[model samples]
Target: MSVHDLWDGLPKAEIARRRQKNAVRWQRRWRGPDINPTTGRLAQHKQSYSDNQKPQALLDEAAQIQSPHQQGTRSSSVTVGTLLDRHLAAKADRAPKTIEADEYHASVVRDTFGDRVLSTIDATEIEIWSQRAEPAASSRKKQLELLRAAIKRGVRDNLVGVDVTEGLVVSLRHTERPYWSSQELRAVVDAASSDFDATMFRVLGFLGLRENEMRTLRVGDLVGNQLTVRDSKTRAGIRTLPVPASVLPSLVELAGSRPKADWLFVSPRRPGNAVSKGYANAALTRAVGGANAIRIDPIRRLSAHGLRHTFAAIALSEAGGNLLSVSRALGHARPSITLDRYGHLAPAGLEPLMALVDAFAVPKAA
Candidate 1:
């Protein structure tokens, strides 16, 4: 007898076991409204996802799967968009900045894999996702991170059989590091038509202050030709960065208002509110050409933080890679962050310090 007949003859408990197996193995099929199979007319399916989903999209995915001619097994899937939505839901409890980053990553994933399904995705898909857009290395990294995070969620949900993203990493072959040339810095400073922006650019480019530190600098903190900045990223960012006499004049202008303990970068929107990073950036662009205002290494463009990188590079390269000292000046929580980032600036590190002994050893010929 056929299995259907045999099942009919089975005991109640056995029948329950068979039904349970079927449900567990059930793969939904998508059959859109019938058309003249000959006419090829397209039809729309109904909406889906309790609040942020669509059933028609899910149903349409089911339509593409075909059972093996000689077997009953089938492949299943969940959509990229669906997975992204779940990630978005996860951000509800995360920090504001973290939520922002996750959203941006989700935006990239949706743009790249809007129609791809989770079951069909693989390392190849991730590789393409990283390169197909061919933007910046940092952007690609964010996209890859988002995909990996979603795949991790899949593993947690039992939606996919394996963590296909196990060893995947964003390609760093063309990753551009951010640094600014002295001439470019001058060009932006000279180009500054607005007092506020010109002053901001000089502070960032010369002093190497981040958006937060730039916004926080004050008149009282300026003493003995050094500016003390309080770091908010960690308690350790509190630091003193001595200024080149050239940067002093601009610091004077920024602190002229003698604004309260309030942020120097404070937004005009509210007298006391922190100045918007966007406004400072926009002003910078206005003062300098868009390209000049943004930092770019030899080949790529970088944002405000690039100015910070440029400063670090200049300091380390000039000082022969004094990281312990640079970390203190840059207000980093730990010296390790400095080493990881600018260790290469210390090309001298490649040659063992013991190599220095060769120079010091009595110059026998002299």
Candidate 2:
């Protein structure tokens, strides 16, 4: 019969009692035949242990009798470095950019715990290491999470018994990126030193494309009113976006006379290559801070990503807070992700809902 069949119709208390009795019996059997080697007589096993000895202590004593190798191979075969290497190797199919970040995080893990055996590292050691690492809250969290994942792989591979990074918490300091108003975006674009720089800033603010996505655009990607993003960070990012009417003229002017295979934005130094992300960012900073344009304060200096936030803010406002429309336009993987990041920028219509709740209230007996 199956184990479930054996338990059928038995009272829970009775089942528990029988289970404990069987466990004790099995423990005795596992301890081996009790006949004394000298007398060939059954010895009193219970009487041999002091009353103060705990059940776990007795189990530990039993474990000590077994060969260490038979108990576990984790200590002998698995080091922190070994588990990290295996984990990284298993992620060979991940994107090169993703793998590069993983390698950097793996290097941090190796520097902290490389020589230690997997079995010897525990939660306390992990917590202590995190405290000493002194990385930013987010970076610390990622490193610990990566270590936890590697150790979990070790557990699945039977190289380790427990995950050491479990239950460790890292508190992050919350900071929001500064977004731009419509006037601020216009001011920055107007300040651009060249037509190319102005068009690039307008594309970022209008289309909400990532820096890398903008750089990889080819002349063929732009049709009449639509711009196709062929390469992106996620599959959801590959999408066709409608070109904003305001930026359409500039985009058309920029693409004029170029072959379909030519890059939409080529570097001034290199005829065929796109502008480097670093140079684009530096140019943007200089343009925004230029004396002739609206002077951007040091605190509100726009980064390339800040322009994307500016797009989200303007799009949500113009769409009357339609999250899905804004999310789709921005090529976010999910509407929920868009909400989490940019919810504050959306219009708050909660006052009407609150009024409805107030109407249902009954008067108190005064």
Candidate 3:
């Protein structure tokens, strides 16, 4: 019978199936067959010749066509581990410190959800995991943020259909940090063991600089009493501060022997490089301990950051409770931010305002 007559005799489903089979057969024939139909063996020789003859672009396109799972819609086989690997690989270009932090966060995520397919991890599952994890508020927030960022990248790469982190509430609790008083700060400075430690303590206390910023300081940054902070945590943090007279001699003494291009706080073990955070932390801890021995209420929680808070508290008092000056001194993006953090330390309400009012008010009839 003719092919048309045979096709006409077949049921609609059978016809459709035959048409699909014929189409596949024609495609294989046109592509020189990937498999031998009779032997059911891969046509290795044919594939080798095809691969050798094909251009790189054509080969890539063909690979994409063969493996549709990697491209458009999310695939059920892609797991959280796979997405994290891809995300971290992309994050290699970020700052080393930032990459290290990302790796730490990724480890936490991998421990929880690594094996689960990306699409299978829904909001409910994430919420449950988060509740079970019960990490500190700050750490929990960072972990969720990292996961959300990685999932977003997965979505862009077509590995995930939806961002499960969406609508999941990761509430962050505000933890109060301890602020040091002037006496406590002075005690720490006096307790510093080495000249370098003493200088570092004085500079940090006077300038309100972050530990990283302090470590990255170059000798040239000190221009007379004005110290130019080039590297900082934020753009607002890149500022120049008038060095307090108390710390000026220490800073000048430290820089007096070093070249202008040299790091102000060079690592003793690895000369020419900036000091490590661990060294700074240890030195600060020792200084705090020593200071505690001399003071009535020993400041047990005085970190490097606490020194900045101490500067803020002292500056706010010295500025007559002016938050604007204190904010500028602290390199805060806004006075509101300074107020939010140090407003409690600000001079009591209405005193300055009442003083202003008194200056303008007419003398009451005596």
Highest lDDT model number: 2
Ranking by TM-score: 2, 3, 1
lDDT of 1 at 58: 37
What tens-digit string does per-residue lDDT give for candidate 2 at 233-349? Answer: 665688999898999899899899899888998998888998887867887878877734545453257788778988898887654547888888788866866876777777788
Q: Write the per-residue lDDT of candidate 1 for residues 253-310, one digit (tens) a residue.
A: 6677674464655566777776676776666556556445454642234477777777
Give one digit per residue, the lDDT tens place, for model 3 in 1-366.
Answer: 001133536688887887776532111112335787877876533111112112322233345436766466345666777677666655656656667887898889989887788777778888877665467755666677778887888777555677889977665544566777677777777898888998998878878898888998999999999999878645567799989898899899888867889999988789889998877778988887887786787677677877887788787765564888888878876675686667777788788889899887978778
Counted clashes in each candidate structure: 8, 0, 0
The local distance difference test score of each candidate is 0.64, 0.74, 0.73
The C-alpha TM-scores of every prediction are 0.45, 0.56, 0.51
The runs of at least 3 residues in candidate 2 whose Cα sits more than 4 Å from the true structure, single-residue gaps closed, are: 1-77, 190-197, 210-212, 223-249, 266-305, 312-366
Minimal lDDT window, size 10, model 1 = 66-75
Q: What is the lDDT of residue 76 in candidate 1?
A: 48
The TM-score between candidate 2 and the true structure equals 0.56
